[model samples]
Target: MLDKIYVIDTNVLLQDPKAIYSFQHNEVIIPAVVLEEVDSKKRYMDEVGRNARHVSKLIDSMRGKGKLHEGVALENGGMLRVELNHRSFQYLQDKFVEKTNDNRIIAVALNLLLEEQTKENGRQVILVSKDALVRVKADALGIPAEDFLSDRVVEFNQIYTGYQERFVSSEVLTGFYKNNGIPIETLQCGILYPNQYVILKDTLRKSVSAVGKVDRSRSFLKKCAFDNEHVWGITARNVQQRMALDLLLRRDISLVTMVGKAGTGKTLLAMAAGLMQTEDLNNYKKLLIARPIVPVGKDIGYLPGEKDEKLKPWMQPIYDNLEYLFNVKKSAELDKILAGISSIQVEALTYIRGRSLPEQYIVIDEAQNLTKHEVKTILTRVGEGSKIVMLGDPKQIDHPYLDEYNNGLTYVVEKFKDQQVSGHVKLEKGERSQLAQLAADIL
Candidate 1:
């Protein structure tokens, strides 16, 4: 077999450092300009920055084996080398030569191609990049270029986070009421995961009824299980109270993604579930929750105080849910719950890079703000025995270059629909209040 050489672009490493080893036994080359690009992004205090630091640590760890400029032996029996060819582009100067980083990376590929042309071994050198324009430019230069395929594109409509609603016959509806509930065997035929919401319909009357999630044991358990149930001395209204209990008490579906407008109990339900599962049931080790700090078009820098204070505004929704779940009237009381429970953690998505999490229940709220690439990076970090739930409303995306159809939350739902390990639900009805539902529908 002929040895294949893969020239990796900087974006690929920043997206995933382990991408170097994903090519199997093939030789991986890192253009020197790519390293410079990676160095520039290392100072960022975001997810990208953490990934940059991780890649640097990975390369630094390889120094004991050999010099990186030459080549380092990967665990998968592949070679990774940092190419130091500082070539210039006179032809590109006529089109675009402002000493841009993109041009510098392209120049390295051109140099490698020219060097390969004279070799008697005649190995194939492919330019692997995550940037679409760079690959187009490489193709124009008569060089082989392709997108990083290890991450693989997911279909737009197949991903399943495990929530669905189906219409059933009046007879089936009667059976649910007569039997006190439907049978597990009958429900299993249609397929269901824990924490999935289903709407039972009366086909004859054309009316519908909502059903809370059920356990794997087919027990009709409430979803969110709150201990005290009063927040700031205000108890949840009858329906809100029931919905909250439904989310917290259920144990079948490990991952639950809830999407709804404000006041719709999305975050509240998730937090309630985390509290019951972690503090009460002790089913999981800890409750690890995170959300992207990217707020609309503006960055986190515009906020005051340190990273934690600046993150507070974005994390307030999480705290609100926590405060309500703990039934704390005072701010200090809420702090005590956080202080007492070492198992419950609220963190930013920025710090999640390169960490392998296990035996924890993770909830990522407002996931619609994340890009497809960013979501993939977060999901790949899940370790064994961990169930990660992502909740967000696609209609309320705040990230640039992301829309309802292309955001990470929707992307996950469409890509994992067939897989039994994941499930998704789109909360259509806003259970907050009559006014809130009206507002969600009209305004």
Candidate 2:
């Protein structure tokens, strides 16, 4: 089939660099303005900057194969080129002179489409982006525009976090309680995925039931393994903790979403599981962790100092959990523990764009702070042999446009509820401390 020409947007590359590859055999067109925009972001020490650098490097390497301005063949059998079109609207430069960047990008797309239309057997030119307003403007201009569907989620309501409910016979319920165990093989009839918590209830009584999970070994609740030793000296104190452990340890449920109030141990449990899986079990090659840096109000502007220094405040929560898990007092001690484990990486979400990660355990904390588009971008980065756990409290969202029911975390839960590969748990009990729990409940 003849490849379609796709005009790549800066935001799309900023979200995922390999986005160019997502088009499969399609020809990707990167506007010069997009590269210029990416260049401006390349110096910052965040996910976006990192992505810009990555895309730059990718384009540079491709130059060895052929001219980047002309086009270069990708390993995936596709062409990538930088489009240099400054001709857009004649009045755009004067009317929206201040909005130079956006106008230039739109101009590139419009020019590409117009150029394509003049061809004898012209191919369609689609402007692919993660920016919504850009799409709106493209539509107004009669250009074919679309949100980068590679990161576009299945649906706002189709993402699942892998928890389910099932009705079992009274005998099964009685057996589960009496023996405190049930074989996985016997439960497979209703079990969805490993680590999925099942609310097994008696069909007749409806109330007689228990909640249990299928273990990593695909065995029933009776034979599942639970890491009793506290991760970094922190033990699972409650049923919710146990549930968290189950979710973390299970191999089949690659996507786990946990929602809870402040003291619910959501982040702690996630970190512990990440540590255990990445450090102890070596189930995955690395533990890649990140969270959106959505401030409560107006922007804080650019941060100063080295990458670690700038990220410290934003990553304090992750460090605190690590400190507790490693049973260390000093920051240096925790740093050493982290250093000893090369696979563990705590990064800002800003840098994760435009990278393809495989064989790693990823954790996105405070996910409620991310927009639907951002969440979709992060999830699509999951390659192979990877598990991504998104933990957050929807009610405590920091994103201005998002709310309890509309946030990305909730969106994932509602969307992927029926999928066999995902799982979700609403951590209810607050185990932080009496005061903290009280504050969480009353406040």
Candidate 3:
């Protein structure tokens, strides 16, 4: 078998600095233009900047092993090279601008393809890029391109939904309702994760059913404790919502992830549960609500105002849910009420990087916008007695580098599905309104 060569793109490294080591035993080519792009972004104070700096440090560290232009040995037994002589644009000059960074990167791959074809037994040279247009252009030039799949936890369709339906005997179903627990093996379901919910149905009677969750022991499927309970004047509108509430209210579970489409009540349910635990039950000291500031389309740039005033626009969705929970009609009145209580705090995820939160109910809304590293950093900040709920619709991600299967929310759901400290629920029904549901379905 011939070894393959993968040409790395700038956006791929910016999305994950460790991408250099992902292609095991394969020749990895980093076009010189990608380094130029990485250098331009290294001075900023964001995730991209950090990743850019990391990439530079990685390449620089390899200098001791060998010259990068000649090729250096990677830790994974792969060869890493910085292509310097492939700047020719003879193939793309007719179709694309010569000076653009993307075209320059594509030119390197095209030149490599031409060089490989001249050999008697040439290895396959493939372009790996996260950008669809780059891959499309590479295909037009007859170079194979693929998305970076190393960070993908699971395919979008195969992602864990936190629950599954199981068929059981009528006697088993009756025992589950009467005794509030049933042995997991009774249903012959194989290897259920701890905290995973199950819908039990009678074989003879389709309508007769019961909902239960796998206990921490993974030995029995126990009935949900808070399915019928109310939280901050809110009740679960569906089965998934009830499971979400149960997870949110559990003190044993440290992390809760809820994913759904728009109008599915992901944020509202999380906020309601946080408010109930923090205020009504007195289980936590404060309710910290936050979300990333990723916009749908073009950014409006910076706004001029105080921090809270500036955040009003980005944090309006959170405030809207709070207003509904508090039954407040005016924003000013809501501010006064929040200030008076002092326990409910609305914060931005930007400022949460360096702080340690203890005895707090932290709800991270729009978590789908966060990357895997960002989510890991946030989770590490959870001090003792803190419960963090990550809520987002994976399908509604606004982050350029994220998608339904690779975002932080989806990452956490898949990675922690089998852990006893975590619980997850994917809400299916939209509870917002008839019109809103229709829009989410059709649009």
Candidate 4:
């Protein structure tokens, strides 16, 4: 039985160009208007444009298999077809105009629905779109509509937090603190991933507590190497922060992801760690910091200056952190200090593509604004002996098409949590100030 027919929108294809074969053993339709929109975006240079071009190539390849106006057999045993000549304006119940792309797509679905009524057991025609407005309009017209789920993390809150609290007997706590390294498998807390942090608390003695991270190589729980170490006069305020610091300082871990809300010290801590590893320890050749040019509010328009000078405003937050770390008070002093330090480089993410970076400590701040493809592109730029840290608050995404579930930072944390070379920590407490913490909580 042909149980379902998926009418995919242009946004869905742009989001994931290989969506043509995702519906296993079901029929997939690309509305006529969607091709027009995809063709218009093929000449662009961004990720969306790249995906549009890829979709066009994919459709073109399928044309040799069979007529696209009829259908072609997908490798996944599904039928793929390009919808044409069913964009009737009179099919819509609403007063939707004809020239609009969204309305034309809806008309194609309406025609499909009407044709299905003549069959005894018609397949359910579901409109799959990434645009929420299109889904809402389809629902008003009694067509089933849903979001494309190829990259979405269902129930994103359930993702790994990277920290766990376990209550233990005072004897176990004593053993952990006395030996400084206990077999984590003996704790009987089930399986633990590499670099996962655990907090031990005494049930009888409420004040007694200890913190350790999982050492998978030795099958033990060991104390953090830099637990008491300070990075640029900054120390870890909590256990999660302590875990983050450990991950940052470790040479074996190449990728680290930190997620938290505002005032959680995510940015400040990452920058501090980057400076320590780059300037003090000489572990890396340089400290390269970049972020997507996402506007927090209204964009201030383009600034008139050289590339470095124009990047000053976009990277001012990083400069602010540097000044705080170096105990500088003014931008002039900070600029003077930065000019003297040849190891520090601040640039926008736009210029980072197709470049090789080796022996560097890279921090991509506000990384949640990046798409998964953008993240992959940035990561592929890393040369040998480089560590990349992604820092962001999933809840504060600024990209119009991204959210907590599908953004680059969240994607990295979820996809790499199981790797031995990757470490993640989701900081919860805000250390900016009491007032800022309260605002983050109640606001």
Candidate 5:
């Protein structure tokens, strides 16, 4: 087999700076235009800027070993090279006359393909990109293209839901309830993770069932702690939500993740649990609600006012849920009430990077827009006595570099399933409204 050449796009590096080493033993080529684009974005104050600077330093360090135009040896037995030639867009002039950065990058791959075709046993050149249009344009120019998939931890359909259904005999089902908890060996099931929810059903009667969660030891199936109780003013409408509430209310579990679609009550229930713990139970000293400021469409740009006013647009959803929970009718009234209650605080995720949050109930909304590194930074900020809940719909990610399978929400759910200190729940039902549920399903 021939070692293929992978031409990476600027977005790929911006999404993950280590993508250059992810090609295994294959040759990796970065178009010169990618460096120029990366330099342009290095001044921003976000993950993209950090990645741009990191990748720039990596490539600059390679200069000591050899000229980038030629090649440099990688630790993974791969080769990294910056393609400086092929700036001419004459080949694609008739097809793509805009002379955009994408076209220039495609030109590099096209020229490499033509050059490699002359060899007796030629290496195939593949254009690797995160942008769909860039891949489409490469295909139009007769070059192979693919999306960078090394960062994706799991397939979308096969992602862990933290729950499963099991059919047991009537005697076992009765014993589970009779004993308050049953040994996991009685289920005779496959491997189960810690804190995983199990719905036990009677084989004779499908309607007769009971829900239990695997204990931290993974040796027993125990009943949920908050199965029928109400948190603040909210109640679980389904089995999954019940499991989520149990995890959220547990002071032992430091990290909780909730994945669901719009109108699924992920954020609302999380807020209720946070409020109940911070205000009602006094388990935590404060409730901090925040979300990423990723705009669904074009950003409205700068706003005039203080930090609170600047954050109102981004944190509106959190405020909406707070209003529903407090039963306030007007924004001014809500603000006044929130000010009186010193336990509740709402802010943007941007300000959370540098602070140590101890003895706080932190709720991160729209967490799917965050990258894995950003999530890691946030999780590390949790001090000695803090519980953080990350809530988001992986399928509804708004971040350009992320998708359903590779976002931070999905990453945490998959990576922390076995640990006793963490728990996860995937809410399927939309409890917001019938119309909202219909829209979520069809749209």
Candidate 6:
């Protein structure tokens, strides 16, 4: 097979700095304009800045062996080149302005496509980008373009739902109920993942059913802790919510991921469980609740106030859920309730970077707005005896650079599917209200 050449855009590098190494046995190109663009974003205060600095370090380390302008050899037998002189304004003069980095990148890809075509060197040149507009422009200009697909973990249909349904013989169902547990080998199904929830139905009579969790290490099908567990006056409204409650209330499962749509009780139930573990049960030292501060649309400027006052608007939804949990009627009373309980701490993910939370119930709400790296950092901050719960609606993400498949919550769910210490639940029903559920379905 002929080798291919891929010209990567700046956004691709920023989305994942190690993306250049993903294309196996293929030549990689980085336009000079992309480096300039990456340099400008290194001053950012978020993950983008961290990625920019990482890309810089990667390129700097490559410079020790050879000049980047004259291609360097990667360890995987691929060539890496920095295209320096492709910022010409000759291509797409009428359709696009040459002042932008996107245009410059397109120009680089166009020139390289022409050069490779003229030489007929048994290679195809394709432009790789994460921006839809850039790919559209490339298609219009007759240059081949594709999305960078390294970070996408799974398709929506292929994503693990953390629960499975299997039909078992009536005898097995009876045995499970009589013994309160069953040996996994007797089920006659394929091997199941650790911590995966399963619904066992009687083949003859589907009405006789049971829900259990697969503990592959112990080789047993233990009944889930759903029937008797209640969190902060909230009971499971459905089977999915019941499974989520089982994962949330378990001390053995250190990390939990919950993905659902609007009004699915993802955030509310997580906060309730955190409260139960921290306040009522005294299982943890504090209930630390936070969420990423991503705006829905164009951000207005910063609000003027102190820390708590500034966070009031961004964190109002969390406070609203707290009010529902505390049954407080007013803001002053909520303040008094919060003040009276030193076991709860309400904050934002912005200030959680450099702290080690020990014996705490950390609830990360709206976690779909976070990138994979940011989520990793947050999970690693979990100290001994701490439980971390991340819950989000993948369909309601506000982060511009993330999507349903590549968001951190989904990524963690997919990655930790088989691990013994991790558990995930996808709440399907919206239990908030009839109106909210209908609105989510149509609009």
TM-score (all chains, Cα) for each model: 0.60, 0.61, 0.97, 0.95, 0.96, 0.95
Per-residue lDDT for 1-443 in model 2, tens only? Answer: 44698888888887677788888788889888888899999997755777789889988878788888888887788888887644566635543455567777778777777777898888888887677887887787887898765554444544443455668888888888887778866765553555566667789997676777765565667523455546645677765676677767778778888888898998888888887877788899999889888776777778899998899888998999888877789999988887787888999988887999999999999998876667788989998999999999877976544456557787787666556677787777889899999999898
In candidate 2, how many Å is residue 57 off? 1.2
Candidate 4 residues 1-443, lDDT tens each? 55688999998888888988788989999998899999999998877899999999999998899999998988998899888867777768455654588888888887888778778888789899889999998998889998887767536467778878889998888888889968977788776778888888899888888888887573889865555457889988887788888888899999999999899998888889999999889999999999989898788998998998888889989888888998988989988988899999998999987799999999999999998889999999998999999999888887766778888888888888778988999999999999999999999
lDDT (Cα, 0-100) at 61 in candidate 5: 90
lDDT of each residue in 272-387, candidate 1, tens digit only: 66666777778789899899876666554677789777778888888887776777788779888788889999999988889998878888989988877788889889877777
The pairs that clash in candidate 3 are none
lDDT of each: 0.71, 0.77, 0.91, 0.87, 0.91, 0.88
Model 6 TM: 0.95
lDDT of 5: 0.91
RMSD of each: 7.7, 8.7, 1.4, 1.9, 1.5, 1.9
Candidate 5 TM-score over all chains jointly: 0.96
Off by over 4 Å in 1: 2-4, 43-46, 63-73, 86-91, 113-125, 139-145, 149-155, 167-171, 187-191, 198-214, 217-245, 248-256, 260-292, 300-390, 393-424, 429-443
Please tell me which model should have the higher lDDT, number 2 or number 4: 4
lDDT of 5 by residue, 286-309 (tens): 999989899998989999999989
Model 2 per-residue lDDT at 329: 94
Question: How far does residue 284 in candidate 3 sit from its true spot (Å)?
Answer: 1.0
lDDT of 2 at 350: 84
Evaluation by TM-score, superior candidate among 3 and 6: 3
TM-score of 3: 0.97
